[model samples]
Target chain A: MTATLLEPTADPVAAVRRARRGPRRRYLAVLGGLIVLATAAFAVNVLLGDYTYTVPDFFRILFGEQLPVATYLLMESKLPRAVLGILVGLCFGIGGAVFQTTLRNPLASPDVVGVTWGASTAAVVAVITFGLRGTAVSLAAIGGAVAVALLIRSVGGNVGSHRIVLVGVAMTAALASFIEYLLSRASIWDVQVALQWLAGSLHASDWPTVRAVALSAAILLPLLAVLSRSLRVTQLGDDLATGLGARRFAPDGMLLIAVLLVAVAVAASGPIAFVAFMAGPTARALNGGRPTLLGAGLVGVVLVLSADFVGHYLIGDITVPVGVLTGACGAPFMLWLLARGTSSRSSS
Target chain B: MSVSTSARLVAADVTIGYGERVVVEALDLAVPDGAVTVIVGANACGKSTLLRGMARLLRPQSGAVLLDGVAVHTRSTRDVARTLGLLPQQPITPEGITVVDLVGRGRHPHQGLLGRWTSADERAVTDALVVTGTLDLADRAVDELSGGQRQRVWIAMALAQDTDLLLLDEPTTYLDVAHQVEMLDLLADLNRNRGTTIVMVLHELNLAARYADHLVAMKAGRVVAEGAPHTVVTEEIVRDVFGLDNRVITDPVSGTPLVLPAGRHHRPSLLAGKSPTPEYEGAEYL
Candidate 1:
């Protein structure tokens, strides 16, 4: 028995080293595959269209070569929408992963945590109540999201898996009702504008919206990546995390940044339902239960771009809003999640 | 790494509790350096509360917990964490976290914001896993492990902290009898080999008597008796602290006092006719 125990001691570090090596290789391979797939899909979306631009022609237009009106369609319209779709997807994915992991609850997404609701409520209020437009709406949306986050954190009492989710759900319901009341009292034209926002769309994507999303992503995504390791520790619960020398404030601060990222995404293209909710869990399921922020972001990009493409082209002249499609898809998904949660609780 | 042998912990009239109710009063206690001190008491007896107070996880309401004559709360959290490690009961492990990753977190005190994983961190993690005999399971997810294996993983996480002072709260909660003895033996080895100061709250009076170098018995948020196990464990103290009818006997292996309760079967034949002994051993065991 002593000799057998001694054998394990000799090769103790080898197992951990090998385990670390395997995960790194697997993570890299998954990331590479997703990048290739996203790039191909992006190329296809850019090149193949109703305006009849070939792949080579699309490339030529991208390289600043003069071509037909089809080239203009490729350069001006589809490119910006596709780019915005990917950027918005990335923000949704990373933001969702951060919120879910930090709260230690699968149901804790930006939508469920009141960040999306906060942004939407602000945008709706801006358009209907204040008659605000353009950049002012976005600024109001950001302020609204930050205020809601701080308020919920302050008044939500204790921090726990169940308490955060319950408080977030309550806040979301309250905000949604407030927005509805504002819509009920608005003038017809203002109500129409608010209604369009309520059904989130990338219909208004131009150089400016794309620029806003790019700028937001550039600032937020790298900051999130830098804080990822600390966030991982935080998921282990506060006492253990603190015992391990993780600061109490850093993880909470990173979560606020994540909320800001989601708010920006919502500001760019209204609160697209379930993209933020579905991305993280979908990525985790695909990656075999390891929480992959980057991979989830990639998945979010794929989800939003594909949904937007289908919504745009599948129904021809109708021009259905992408948010409508997502809500249509997401409502059932949320119900299914609720059903699963109830069943799991009963069984457990 | 070897710790200084004479590292003493002094609590000068320390009072600790939550908001209004003071659990531990203005009581002075000294834990000798490089000794295994086991705290035993009933539930809500402030054994775990005192351990938390000493670890600076709880602030004292009145006095101070001092390490080497310095107030523990005055030091930075990182400084305190580096020297004093605590294993809390019922800590939640993040889903799908591997043992190596969890153990690696124990090195956080030694690492800075700019510092990535170093050779020292790697060595500490590896050493911890090895010492706890959990190296083979390092790649396994924590949730997938057995109860005994999971407890060892938690101990490995604490060991990876590389602190000279370790405090544990009910470390053998869910373990079987065999595993409980094994854990206490491992802790005893750690204390003896490294000269590490170990303070633990144990519910089992017999186990505490068998394992501890120094034993503290508490009742209703007060220290009733404290000394070497042989000197502290007595029938009168056991009856008063736990309110159980138990006889004190010498443990053959450890040569320490062991409390064997006189249940229904063990009651004398003469007393059986006059008044029947309680059939169930009381709620104290439960």
Candidate 2:
């Protein structure tokens, strides 16, 4: 017997629109609130310290009305560090999120992808082998990161997430060993300088480093925002994304740009640990399940600023590196993740 | 909503295969518009490959697949997607993705860079969900659904594309017999109600005969027979195509041709062996 089922009547567009709107608004509100809180924390961090200044005194120092020697410390020394911490944190956090989501793997951070390794290796080589000084090492680091990225992509075949990660890890390991070998043969003074740099300390911050990072951020962040939709489609696998009319090359280009941004940040401030790994997932978890680029950037800002504050002021006589603090926190989390992955695989 | 658009798909002398090993060669076929066409063949006979080529998933080595007199490969992918949708066999679903979100992705071609989650896209997604009887499960994660439910959700995703031409590769795969019948009936209903042109590769001959308005039987990458089920299916044709001893009988309900094979286990009784049985009558021997 032949019978026809009548087409059902419903408003699909309204349903999907409703679905997307609720999450978008909630994420935006949460991000906005976090931004305000981070700014307040930063203010508190700047004003209250060993040589304390009132809020009014801090504003006076900020505008160029000089007060005492303590005012200069608050304005020049601590303020710049706080600002730089926020900026670099933003770069690492958002950059890490884009990398992980695009790859569809949570472990695919810029550090895991050899960007950090490339930058650190180049910086170390420039200092010890080539006798380079000042910001020259930063430039060398960027070049190294780009070269490693291109090399990994070439060797990994198709630009899928898994292949990229595998190639990146292999290249990073090789380069890291070479860096260690160089360090072993260097003089005591050279080794001390290299070790301190590798520990990722923001010991000396000036207007120049800030300007360079700001310039790079200004160029890269807008590019990432424009290509965000394409990245979302790319996360749905290649065949489906291509069928949906997105060019396969667009996501790859965006990913390369993200790598460049993170590389620049690492070159400026050394490979600060865990900021890249924690920023994206922390933001996403706080803002619900949607991919949160801007939110991650804000969370990165909070992470770096708080770590810098604690590093400088928490221990009385001893100064801990911001990277050290991040490592101290992040290493345990990594071990937990590894344990989870192993257990899941075993059960399966 | 009542838009009557018909596009004929033609494959001319198509040769398709992976590298170094040719599967189908110099094949010519025309898929009729606004009709349910079933392609039937044994395993590895290139039925799925032909469907893939027609959907432009695979590039033809020697020929072209044309849509309404124009080469399909020449048009932009989005333009082609607007008119056609292809549901591949056993696609993987991303983790924690709800049925509504998955189905909403089918409207990607219709959405512009700035035009996401529009009212029209939502309408198409809802319509697809309702048509496939998946509206109630729209909020549930796709991975959590049953096999039949998951299959219907995928069909909903394709339907949400709102294309006039639909191609399916073994849509009833990994389902129970009841679910297979239910899926075929759903496809037939869609063809009748929306005038959506459909072509599918099916392994079940009886189901294809019952549902398809036209059947194209392929053997060794060539069309061995093409006609209505009653005209094409016969005892000799079955033996030639499938290499089996079988008898063709009319289905009691649909009056369609049905094949019943004579297996080694089915033995003739002593009384039946002694008598001259009629053409349609057979002795029950177990």
Candidate 3:
């Protein structure tokens, strides 16, 4: 009976649907795998810290039976950092995917396009120069991101991806020098804080940071989801999008949402280096080269959590920042991608 | 391809441009209902700009484009999208999107935020795939298809829009000769069977003459000729539009006008009792 139903002549529509379902199912399954991997990584992140909690002890902390030392570590450092890692990962991943899709270039993520550094430069300078901390720094960073985006748009003149990337790279260089100059001029104590913040460390993360990011996510994620449909239409290029009845500035809202997410993530953590740059590409690979926001975000969660875990436990006594590890991993991959891109362009 | 009954898209005194430079100026043209209207011109003669204006891709710098006697620019774009479909010159295919899903995106105007992906959308996509003969390629990646197949897939996407009017801009840019003919034939079939009011910018004069019921000619952002294919595809009009001395002949197969450019070198070969293929003693490139 099932075989009869499966026959093409009996239901050609069903046959077409069934044939189409295979790749989509594979994409979903890859996304599911990334989710599972991220959840497992998140668990490992909470379980293995300075005072290592066994699986059973971890459950006890989760279930509200809090022993003194274990509970203190769990509540103060471990839980907040793990949660913040996942949150930051989601933001960077989704943000990167949005930028890449909007600009139609793999290298157009927030980090590569200088939006992440825009936030970082503002936050770092705010801490060093203005003596601002916490929410004020975050707000400044958000403003900086918007300002940088506007500046890039103004300078780049709404050109192709390659030209915009060149402008972004120049912007990033200018801002990086500004940051370095700020670090050089700061007093020794201010310099340490600025350096940590510039490296995009989760070391300063506490319950408040996690809560703040979570609250922002609660408001922003839904908004991004709502706007993502228009983003999808905009991905088919301006002419086609306009033809499809999308408003002329439809992608503007989505880009702003993505920048806001990046700002919030960068505020909670530091710039968190290549998590934004790497997430979209990794997710596309896993999803069979389809640039999905969810998949990219999931990939980012895995990358950040796993990088944090590896940095803390696997690398021994010296505690490296998540941003450092991501930078180390991302540099070679970015170079390889650039090389492959040039070869492909030449061939085409 | 819904039957176009009352859907009339026309540009009245419309001018279009990128920024300061005007591409099309004061173009007063009416797309005849339920027929294939092909706009032909030399490169950068504003055929594309005219199509863009008619499709509402470009807001006219002056005057207005009318859809069913309503100003197209003033109407809600989502509402207009339901009645008219456009396939641009070079559309982007998002990486790794399957043929079916890509075509299914055409149902965008029909969807609400929460009520997206309905059974109606499924039926529209399926019918589009069937009509374009892309059902077998439904599971295939759009980026991986051949040039001709990709063109069909794009047409299928436009068909899934289920609009009474469809506009296309240079739909046969990179296609080879046979595929170009096949593409034209498929569009002709859609025009004949569905009564879709099709308007397109085409570079090929012979193909345009053969397929277009209504042929419009443009030169330097202005219309030089507008009427039936025979009236529009004459030698004088060709010279006027393209600035080329050309001989226009009746197509052996379709009885439509075929343009043969009378260049300095080719004229001697035409006069001599010899094959037009230039003789070369050297070996062909391997």
Candidate 4:
């Protein structure tokens, strides 16, 4: 290595490119593997129920040829459920990663930082108190998330990233109580629907839910693509980022996009717990510990779809909500991460 | 050098501060083109703040920092970035980032939003690594490098920006004496060979005097003295700027002014019979 460095390469450009190729190939390989896994998980979620269908059968139904008993079930329930899973997963994954990167903290995922809670609180209030349904609940969720984001920003006072995160945690606590109060007053029939908001479920997945999430993805993905270039600069901290000619408002733009993504995902999937929190860190770990938003989004699809499938088919007789399964696992992992972070910091 | 005739960066009565606490008040400086200028001051004397104002990191309240007769703040950030580069006092090193990737980010201003990693970008990055003598460590993670090496890698990153003008804040802050001299020497080489206009905030007065073609001494947010090291490093200005009672003598190695502080206890009389007559034995303090 020393000899190579001492004797300058004939073409420095080629040498640099050769040096970079290893990591680039590894990153691309990880992304490709994730895409394949997500597709398989989507297929499993859609096709591998009590009544199984082959790939050709699924594709045939997709092209509008009806099978005997499979057509109705696949079209109405399984297909929409799988599609909504992919959409929400993509949204939460990208949103959570963006939030984490922007705040420069692993603990700053949307679900952990009160964004999902905001959506849930508004959604519960809309369902129980206002007797709202369908699209109304989604709108309330989006409004609630945006309102909470603004509140956190105002209360945090622009001092530090941790201040905003602390304010968000406090808001999450306060909003949790408000949600509980609304739930206590809800009628039994209303509570059944409100439970979807409290503990997230894909059981309520329908064509409308899928369409609403798809619409959001259509708007947000383009914005994310444009804004992601700034992420590379912003990760270097404000002083250097500004010196490197990054737009002053780039971080704010990223945060806004992340908020909208989380809000829309929660509106569709009822704030499926920890999908937003888990996906980014997982994808980053897979990418050799460098953050990748696209990888995170793809991982989110796999996580939610696989978890939903496990809850429905892999478990025994009783079906579990996807939220409960994720929350069961995610809460402990978050504690572990926090503990590790504190210990490492103190030791260092 | 004629300051008015050849100055590329001129701070015209810039009063800059954070919030209402004004740190630098009505400070004017013309950084001579194609020369190394070092700003030296005691703590909270606004040398770093002055550099920030010139680098466009802070806005002057009433006056302007002009580059090529145009206000820097009024120009697009990319346009200013192409002409100038700044290495902040403490720049963050991203986790697990290689030296090459970190240096390559310096090409940001030259690239469009959707710009590909062109061969020119590759060459610039490679050139930066070579210039900083860090090509061997190009594939290494930044955090794993030693303090001196990490700092050189950061300089390489700044160099990759390929700006004619470079500003550094406390570039030798945490390094040992040997590394500090090494860092300043590398910068001097850049100025001499590439004619890159260099301005920096340096804590070590001796090193500053050695490396700076133009030396500035500041006190209480204003310029106390600025000229060649021989002219600027008089005992009177040292006392004025740093509140140190010191004797200025010629540096034996570099032939620049060197300050030797004299406390109430350590007097010049102690060295009377120990060494030959000092260079400034009978010279006036000024």
Best by lDDT: 4
Worst 10 residues of 3 chain A by lDDT: A1-10
Docking class of 3: acceptable
lDDT of 2 by residue, B1-286 (tens): 1212343888888999999888878898888788888898778888999998888878899899998788877888778888888887756575546688778878877888664577788778878877788776767767678888888888888888888889898999999999999899889888988988889999998898898877888887878887677766888877777887778899998899998876543424533565534334343442
- lDDT of each residue in B192-246, candidate 3, tens digit only: 8887889999999989999888889999999999878889999999998999888
Which sections of candidate 1 miss by over 4 Å?
Answer: A1-10, A335-348, B1-8, B263-286
Stretches of candidate 3 off by over 4 Å are A1-10, A159-161, A339-348, B1-7, B266-286
lDDT of 1 by residue, A1-348 (tens): 111123464565677687566656777888887788778767766666576567777777889997767667766788998898888889888898888777767688878879788888888988987899889998888888888887777776544547777888899999989988998899998988787656778777788889988998899877776667676556666666666666657767778888888888888888888888888877775665677899889988887887787788787777778878877888777776677556532100
Q: In candidate 2 chain B, what residue range of length 10 has the lowest lDDT sum?
A: B277-286
True-vs-predicted CA distance for residue A101, candidate 4, Å = 0.4
Q: Mind giving the per-residue lDDT tens digits that candidate 1 earns over B1-286?
A: 2323454687789899889999998867787678888999888889888888887778899999998789988877777788888888878776567788878888878887754888888889888888888888878878788888889888988998999889898999989999999888888878887777999999999999988888899887778998888788999999899888888888887788988887655666636566663556673366
Q: Write model 4 residue lDDT over A100-179, tens digit each, in one string.
A: 88888888888887988999999999999999998889899999999998888778765236898898899999999998
User: Fraction of true contacts reproduced, model 3?
Assistant: 0.49
Local accuracy by lDDT, each model? 0.80, 0.78, 0.84, 0.86
Model 4 lDDT tens row, B124-188: 89888877788777778787889999999899889999999999999998899988987888888
Better of 2 and 4 by lDDT: 4
Of the candidates shown, which would achieve the greatest TM-score relative to the real structure? 4
By lDDT, rank the candidates, best first.
4, 3, 1, 2
Provide the DockQ value for model 3.
Answer: 0.42
Candidate 4: count of backbone clashes, pairs at least 3 residues apart or interchain: 0
Runs in model 4 lying further than 4 Å from the true structure? A1-11, A339-348, B1-4, B269-286
